[model samples]
Target: MKVKELEEHPTFAAVLPPATSEEYDTTGWRAFKPVVDKEKCTGCLICWVYCPEPAIIRTPDRKIEFDYKHCKGCGICEVECPVKAIKMVKEV
Candidate 1:
């Protein structure tokens, strides 16, 4: 059960499947979209920069935008936003 032992096991390596676009497509529907409260926002771009999916965008004036198409709704941006501007709302 040690970390080193697990790393050396072929079974662990065999458990994972090879990457494919189908895998990505199938999971696309599960992604969440973030809702921003512009009234509460201070125009900070913390959410824009911290998003792992690059779902957040920053305008020339530092306004924030989210592209729900590619966003997995991981909530990292919402948790990292200093001004509490981003809220992770479940996608319907």
Candidate 2:
């Protein structure tokens, strides 16, 4: 049978349940939050730009902030920071 014909079969529907919250739940998702020491922050935007998820935001004054909602804690920002201002801490 053609791929499209197979996809329409009732048997396929029986085997495949509707998508549910359990299928996409991220209860186990772990992320690292980066803490910036204001004393060490040089106002460089490197961390903001290097974050793969754009989790870091830089203010007009060059102070950096992190949006943990989308941050995966990849540590790229910590590695990219010129000074040791950014430190990765496990999210609670």
Candidate 3:
């Protein structure tokens, strides 16, 4: 069960679909959700830049929005926000 052995196995590779597909929804995997405080936000777009899923969105009005449908809630936005506007709250 070594990492290298599993990667080289045809059975393992064939069974697991590629995770790079645009339609692969990862919202179910989220343990926490990011919440943004609009008052505290300065429209810096830092969260949008640091997001791996690129789920943080910028509106036409220069406001920020979240795409919870595909957001994995990895907390990169919360960590990267210089204004501390985004917070990762418990999913419950």
Give the TM-score of each candidate.
Answer: 0.62, 0.64, 0.72
Cα lDDT tens digits for candidate 2, 1-92? 89999878676334566645334533235466788898899998988777776667887877988776566777888888999899988777
Q: What lDDT tens digits, residue by residue, belong to model 3 across residues 26-78?
A: 78899999999988999998788888877888988787999988899898888
lDDT against the true structure, each candidate:
0.71, 0.75, 0.86
Ten-residue region with minimum lDDT total, candidate 1:
18-27
Tens digits of per-residue lDDT for model 1, 11-92: 6334555644323532365456688887888886777767776667776766877776566778888888888888777766
TM-score of 2: 0.64
Give each prediction's root-mean-square deviation over alpha carbons. 8.5, 7.1, 8.5
Residue pair clashes in candidate 2: none
By TM-score, the best candidate is 3
User: What TM-score would candidate 1 get against the native?
Assistant: 0.62
Model 1 segments more than 4 A misplaced: 1-31
Query: How many residue pairs clash in model 2?
Result: 0
